[model samples]
Target chain A: MRIRSTLTFVVAAVAALGIVTPAAHADSTPTVRELLDKCDNGTDSCVFHPSSRTEFGGARHQVGRNANNCSTVNQNESIAWSDTTGGSNSIGITITAEYKFGEEFSVAVSATYEHTWTWSHTVTRTDTLTTPPWSVGQIFHAPQMQRVTGTYELHFGKKFYGHYYWYVNNFSATGPEDTDDAVTFFTRAMTGDERNRCPKSVSTAKEFVSTESTPAQPALVASVRPGD
Target chain B: MRRTVATLIALVAGLAICTPATASAAPATHCTLRLETGVVTCGARLAAVTNNDVIIGRVFDDQNYGGSSFTITGSHPCKNGNGRDFGVQLAKYGWANRISSLQAWGNCWLNLYSGPNYNGDHDGEFKADTPYVGPLMDKRTQSIGFD
Candidate 1:
């Protein structure tokens, strides 16, 4: 049935400002650390923007690992991870809080993106409305996918593009092909609770300065560069 | 001829991998789980779902969505386009909502996606014959078997 219970964007973001009880809202895992230091995983850190785990409604997915093979993608898919000790072959993604704008670290992140040949567009844009946001977010998500309804509170995070060869990536947006086999099979990861769902991320080092009242249509919001 | 033989081999292999050969099955029992089609807020999670002690191989009327009914057709495995099987959960069907975890005559597989029910949408096919392996809730009463 349509389980309309779970938290969404603005609600999740507002939760972040209150007493951080990630344990309750978080999907059965330790997420506090994920919010504080997202880069702990280094350059290979991950972000699953469009996930099969339907945490939203109706056939809502369970909080833990979705160890099911996706017929659509023709690959073994999973967004959850194991809690065991030794290093795992699996790669995991987590959503965390966003903070710290344009600092030395931000400069470093920006510089890293520059080195990656894929990134071409300027960080700042003139307009700012929103686009139709046609990604996996649109494909399988049960309820309608709102590109820029001003509901989502994305912090510093972006999508995890490359393999686990590094920690979290410099950029954070992704597409279907952006993922690799190593990460496609990852498990055992933790992102904080509803309060701090927007974990700090290095996706966009600088605040995307909008020129004026006329914002970039959500469609103009280009996706992030894949790898570091 | 060759293709049919290959299919047979694959089917047997999948069963061996999914279930224990010597394991005692609970004897083809039929069960159903129900959930509310409402919003989950302020503590009201999954309402309740009870099992109606039915036997194996015998299909029953799936009354999951309050009233709308559908006969359980069959069950199968979760496979890629190429046909290699993986760790997947089985899916069964009733009427509006899909039925899963079917076991009769040692034959079972998950039914993929059907468009929508009265209230919700049936996602897609899941792995078949996979064990639920949920927590063990002891039955309150003991029973004597008929000779």
Candidate 2:
């Protein structure tokens, strides 16, 4: 009886001193989604930095419609993404064009394209409008462009059996769902006069991801043209 | 009478010791990141978690990301001989020859080798998440590349 009591006392003492450590098993690892929720609940193991606004001008790639004093003109524009890494990337940019001639000359393109290397999905928009026979040298204007917005997650790993931490990398911006408008040009029939004529405008917008966790990601850029 | 007393004592001591061990059998780390502020928090977490900065790839010691893990991160994606050349030498990081599954993100594809420095038996071009890297390649990864 005395020996048993001594052993029990020794065990309790060791337990109190915290000399015993439990074995760790990795069979029930937590999913990434679960961890994200923990962060949302304001756990300190995760470091979060709010995203800042990044506004960029979409370079305008213009398609010119020459005036035919004889009649109205019909125009059609088609766009698509021919190459990409697929839909893991959900962000897109919208393009539009407005003519300085009048608000009636305003063209809003709801067609949004993903930021990818090759363009595909032939989206064609057609419009027909009358032009004043005497009107020449008409210029179309491009209004303000849209901004990119979103958040990114950075998971940092340590050399432990089953341990990791993460940071919230955010990007915030407020702008129209659609971006830059297109402009049409008119030329008067005159000899040695190029003033009424505007060369084609090709605008390219490059999207970048800014995070304190990594270098600027320029690979997310896409180039668009009026007819291409 | 003596045997019964001894057995009772052993049972009581055994329960006292085994209780905490059972309670902490699984020491999984749980973490999360806030969308608005970009802050992260963790629960039932580890004492330390080092940031690798930019994440390009991740390796798991078990299938379906259910074990110890090592994250592969760099300034840029894995490139050929030049460019960013983001490659991880597992042995150098104390994870040599110990990988069973993996994933690639940040515009990257993965290439695995059984030996370090792009040597040994090779497999992959894994552009998608792979739950299992095959028996021949399981836990045989000595080097990794992010392309």
Candidate 3:
């Protein structure tokens, strides 16, 4: 009896103070803020690129093959940072559009060599295309290992009540962002004669892509409001 | 006794070398739809495939086109250039980011992306048989746009 009287007095006092306390229900509707918070906890219907809770630091590697003799070397080196969030997005907006990443960066022809025999002697030529941020005079010798650091970004999206919410979280990291090995060669340069004596032409290819691109749950829901 | 042991070792090594290796698994549920006859063929192999048929592309679960595979066929043949395009929603078919290798057909250029709706990290165009989709794109393919 005494505890009940105290509870009633407290309720009366709270009501007199004009503070409206939300009533608790077994099946209460979550607000927009609550839904967004669920995305942060990675427990709701949200999709994360790379992963919802992990750091990506893997590198993409390519190794040049051995040449027989009088060979040509051609290669395409590329590193791309893209979003992999997918689901039934009813809001008609792209998940990637909502979550931005670095970009699709590629080196069309990173290295090239040509060996031609005119009438008199064999003609040999080699060239390496260096784009911005790449140190000039960096050559990728034969039988060399070329590696490009992976890029990282955080992108996520969620669908709630026929609407969608997405965020990039303002967090991104490039393989070379804080490392000296943005693009590095593991082996030493081959001599001109050795390069010319390569057994066969060497062509190498490189690529970068998402580590994980699946959502934990589907992002589709009915169009009903909370209490309706 | 030593000679017998050596012969047994050699026999075991020869068996290991001559035994046929198991091929990688391909997607078992995916099928091919022939646009001309509307015939659906499941577990169709694209090896030695000709260009006369209306083919969209083939996605592999393993690199070098090994393992399980699936073919995509559309209503009409893919255009020579980029006239009309067919975008495969990989997630709808439960194939998002599961492709390690791919090949284009029907004179179409297979364009890969890491995201849905063809957004993010476009992996250029591939008209040749790509045994491996490079270090970056391997297993990162989410969608393929044929044009």
Candidate 4:
């Protein structure tokens, strides 16, 4: 009966052209906590930057002010800073989030950093008449040497879900006329007991798959004849 | 002259009975271990502990652990070489899973991990009086060092 109505109109036109193929809706990819919640919801596809600083004697010592906000996603959050003139600073901050899924498959990275600072300077001298022999205005109070440094870096590029780079560096120094408090509140309570023996957080996740799929190209008009 | 005062009274009676029996037989040179409650304490220094507790040596303080578990032998009680350095603070101060348990005395050797910096996930290498049970470090230990 007309070859059963032409094989039911050629299988309903190849099932309506595989239901309007567009690579079958591009297989909907995007996971890794939804691209780390779209880079922690800052949107615009994710990329953040933060900076801070405070100085003394050379001026520009605001000491504080650097809100810092990202709210966590692929995880990396915690920022802090404290200062008290001539020297006495405590800073511990770490923010890291790196993700690369597909395109070449898996890649997830994280790094954390923390630092404490203390610097002091104070000096006043004069009592010259051949080594403390006589006084022409004798003043003494000396203890000077202060230095503090901090740095954090994050760099992720090229389709691990696209580009990103972040860097933060903090600094402070004192000497020559000295200061006395270069880290002491009992040495910041012994660096808070060595930051309580480190390792607060560092995250990771991974996955990679591609085990062959390209064997359906041998059917290009392989055997069909009807009235021509 | 009366035999030199009888040889100085037998060398001051053998130095006062060998100096309090060697200072009551060794007291603290460093020791603080808490491998999940298998407690151990010894300090001639370092005692101010509370937050989970773990600090081995090299000038110590912050010590807490009075009982709930204790046993590490290789000669029952004698420390030196900075008592094999050790320290722990699994949570608070930024939180993270916290599980711990470990024991190693004498020649001392320990280096276990799960994270907290020694580059996590190694979980091995213990010596002498061994004993490291599961949760394989529950809460996932951050870092533990000794040699």
Candidate 5:
């Protein structure tokens, strides 16, 4: 009976002290700030190419020695960050449009990500396109420019744990014969210290040049029948 | 007994040598297109195809060249003589003038034509990762021959 009383007393004493064991720390994943540092420092693993263009069709003939130029510039920015959250991780993406080049205006952003656990896994992607308002005079005049900006916070599930990439498809303008150019600043999940280190613009300037030309008309040819 | 054993071994070895060896099969390259949504899926090792064969998908049947897509896998020069012509086979399966997109898997070039028998106006030359032949070639394609 005395031994039982002594054990009960010890249990009561421990409960009164509120002693609790702590959990093990989770693995460390690189933050958005760290990724920005790597990009600024020019690491081989995280390199940024400033300019890209996609020409849909070759230059063709137009009226009065005019030619069609169907090319658009694409600005891409990609950063890698780690996530220790067992659930979804959230990050903010901001696009500040500094200038514009041509007539029709639109902006598109695409985010691509992959899971590291599988082999030969295809990248999953999502895209959003927006067109700001423009006036008729701005569409016709030379050196037309506009400033636009946007911010978006994206939540990624735990399945997309390894690496993530965001692409800004800034189409400043489009026409039969036209030019589009713009400067966009991008920041995502940036902390106060990281914001100061991030570059103002993730891309460089691209220019489109065209010239007038004339071509001779094709001559008509008579068809030959099998029995003729 | 030793002589008999030696003869049996020799007979077994001869049989093994005489049997015809099976030819090594080529790895399959898969290209899947979701019709309703216009989504395309391609295999990972598309760049590893080293032959001159091109695979063209056609709708079961529809006259006015409505819905179709093509994928060319394997490494080959983008020229006439080097690549085999699958145009005849495609036309037989009701694929004439119905191509919608072209997917270049390997480092090869593809030429899209507007008429069958490789005649009429030429559309354009397409390379890797080009989603579709623009609006000009989208359902207006009558024939296609890869280089």
Candidate 6:
């Protein structure tokens, strides 16, 4: 007589079956935080530290602007623009959305780039900050975004799951350098669920997932994890 | 006959005190599986899993992660081919491993590298406890090297 069988397997998600009350919408367009760590209801809800933010303000919905110089000298020094003596810097970028029941998605950052001397008598100029408009690479210029954050869900014998990342900073004048350009984008999660109904829409593949390379670079970005 | 030899020794000591004693029923633990890179031989799906050595599978990593391979199997601690070749050299360049609270299937993760960027993630389960619903995430990456 050996009849012992127990199965309490609950890998439930779909946003945990209902409840995605993101009411407020006076219209700003850019509040997408479809997480998936362990809470699925239908469109893929199980992304724990899911996040979203598109601030750098652009002075009000412009989402575009630039100026940079994290100037720290001696990467082997060279700074010679006619004996230096000019300064100017400013920074502020915001588009916050807190809700995983509240918030801790920290990022109120500021910026500063210095070297403002628009000159007038004859002509004197300088502009050393290459091209990059507050990039995560301009988030692919908004291809409907299923990214720009991290973590996603859905896997096992059918396919799909994921882990994307960010800690982008450029267009800098100050405040956005935990250090070195940050990048990572592992993936799979995108199965079902939709915050309540039509929260944009993007179901990660339900699968038999396997990984090993594809721009999945991340050790510590966004908040810092290298040497400090 | 001495009361029938004491009733045949009290019926042989009550049939040896109603014999019944045995123990040893625990053995079925294997892991280090790889999917997308290939392999899902759970035929009848292991009869719909309660625990058939835990081999749930899936594969599709290729948006810069191309085709790779992996394996680790049973009581995994280490040296099962050196922990399955160090999880195939951390999925051969990208890396992945974030399995949590999985007494059964509430949280799960494993990807060597699929594309763009990766690592540090957990809680996106599958295989029978199925909750994701239907499919959608396959944008096309393919990064084994040489862009």
The 10-residue segment with the lowest total lDDT in model 4 chain A: A103-112
lDDT of 6 at B101: 10
Model 6 clash count equals 82
**What TM-score does candidate 1 get on C-alpha atoms?**
0.13
Candidate 3 wrong stretches, greater than 4 Å: A1-228, B1-30, B33-41, B44-53
Q: Give candidate 1's error at residue A121 in angstroms.
A: 16
Clashes of each: 50, 35, 16, 24, 4, 82
List DockQ for all candidates.
0.02, 0.01, 0.01, 0.00, 0.01, 0.03
DockQ of 5: 0.01
**Model 2: per-residue lDDT, tens digit, A90-113?**
223221222111111111111112
Task: Tell me the deviation in Å of residue A217 in model 6.
Answer: 47
Please give the lDDT score at residue A170 for candidate 1.
19
Model 3, total clashes: 16
Per-residue alpha-carbon lDDT of model 5 for A44-154, expressed as tens digits?
112111111222321221111111111112212232222111111112322122211100012211101110111011212222211111100001112112222211111
lDDT of 6 at B65: 13
The TM-score obtained by chain A of candidate 2 when compared with the true chain A: 0.27
TM-score per candidate, chains pooled: 0.13, 0.29, 0.30, 0.17, 0.24, 0.18
Give the higher-lDDT candidate: 5 or 6.
5
- Model 3: per-residue Cα lDDT at residue A48: 22
Of the two candidates 1 and 2, the one with more favorable TM-score, higher being better, is: 2
C-alpha lDDT of residue B52 in model 1: 17
lDDT of 1 by residue, A16-78 (tens): 212224656455322333442434232121221110111112221223223321111112222
Judged by lDDT against the true structure, how good is candidate 5? 0.25
lDDT of 6 by residue, A1-228 (tens): 001112212232221111222355323211233322222322222222221212231111111222211111101111112211111121132322322211111211110111111111111223232211111211011111111221122222111222111111111221122212222122121122211121222111112122433312232112121122
Candidate 3 lDDT, A10-129, residue by residue in tens: 100001001111243213333323333444243212322111011233333332332221211222233222211122121223233223211211110011101110111111233333
Q: Model 6, residue B58: displacement in angstroms?
A: 11
On DockQ, the candidate that comes out on top is 6
